[model samples]
Target: MIGILAAAALQADAPVEWTALQQDNIQVAELAYDVGIALAVICRDDQLMVAITGLPDPAPGAKFRKLEVNIPGAELQASTWRIQGKATISLAPAVYARRLRTADHLTVRAPAEEGEPARRYELALPSDHLALDQTLEACDVPLVLETDLTYDPTISAVTWATSPRITPPNRLPPGGYAEVVLECTVGARGRPENCRAIREQPANSGFARSALLSIRTGRLGLIDGGPPPVGGVFRTRLTINVVN
Candidate 1:
């Protein structure tokens, strides 16, 4: 019984032979060999993740070892590295949650060393351009964000029209001036329809009315999807010219 127990202890402390991994965008910084091998990685915390290239054997299943990552250029302060699955076994690649936006951004805050201010840097992560659960065939798959946008419209022509009416002032002093507001409906077709004076001036309102009639009438453009403009109001200032 004593011999059997001693042999079991040695078996438990044996190291499993493995090959060095060549993952794109990831570099293996250090490796420690003990009862089991431990790997240290230097990679971007945002978007950069890890994955197991080779699978375990068909029989019992390959065991997941523990993995560690060191963020260089950071002050050695009291900090803890968080790992998913809460398992000490070899660390797996960092899993990212699905985000429905233009791009993903992460800001890491590390204690500033002696002179450098508390260092804070932003990292832009690759977006999941493909749909969820999309299988990737390539060993090195590049994740990209898909953006669908519409183009802007170009103006073919533009024209402005003015009214031909005089506005009356409230307290028409010797030669005071005032402006009246004219309400017109400009449709998407670019035609000025229902042209009329919604507001009135004091006595010389006729002059203001004539000024509004000077505007030209025409179709602006094809209104296939655009809604026609309704109840549009425009302000026009008219000088009061009373006949002598």
Candidate 2:
């Protein structure tokens, strides 16, 4: 009983931050509640997060879990990573933000595992969407929160002047296939910068690591029609299929 009161007091005293704030080169916009839950967008990494404070550690060898996320009319499944008590989702950041922008509340359901009963949490969100907007803006992702994304970025006219070497992982199965989607920024001289994997197949396979290496040396070639505006988002998938 006393502990519950203490938690409530802590919640009341905590400062409210609804805008994207920078700390140590990483920018984030988040909404936290007294229930020990927070919805966050980590801009530098281009990932969404559901942070639950004081959550217990997972059993050994657990890599990920499917979390059910609920907004107005959609019930989405999130592949969540348990990191320091937070459920981090590393899929399409822009799409996630767009769906969340107009939501009045967010609900997360954690399915029961290993005999533990399932758990559910519902949280209210602000009507104003300044923070969410900032996240998309910071990454130069298109503004589609108000409407469906109709704009497809043009990379066709652009060529790779200095491109990274996409190679198959050394330990990959002889006849296996792997792919990774990278979110990168078009830096000076059309080179890709700050690239990170947003999706990967066969988790723990070295595909994601290799893909990053491939982008490390990639540079775009363009003229009148070109890659996304310098600093705009550039997403590309790297694939390796080794057939015997």
lDDT winner: 2
Off by over 4 Å in 1: 1-178, 217-244
Cα-based TM-score, every candidate: 0.21, 0.48
Superposing all C-alpha atoms, what RMSD in Å does each candidate have to the true structure? 27.3, 15.9
State which candidate has the highest TM-score: 2
> Candidate 2 — worst ten consecutive residues by lDDT sum?
149-158
Quote the lDDT for 34 in model 1.
33
lDDT of 1 by residue, 1-244 (tens): 1222223223333332222333564332222233222222223322333321111111122122211122221222122222223112212122221121133442334344335455443434334323221211122222332211111011111224333323343345344443444445565445556666544444453544554654333333322123334444332233455554
Clashes of each: 21, 0
Q: Which ten residues in a row have the lowest lDDT in candidate 1?
A: 147-156
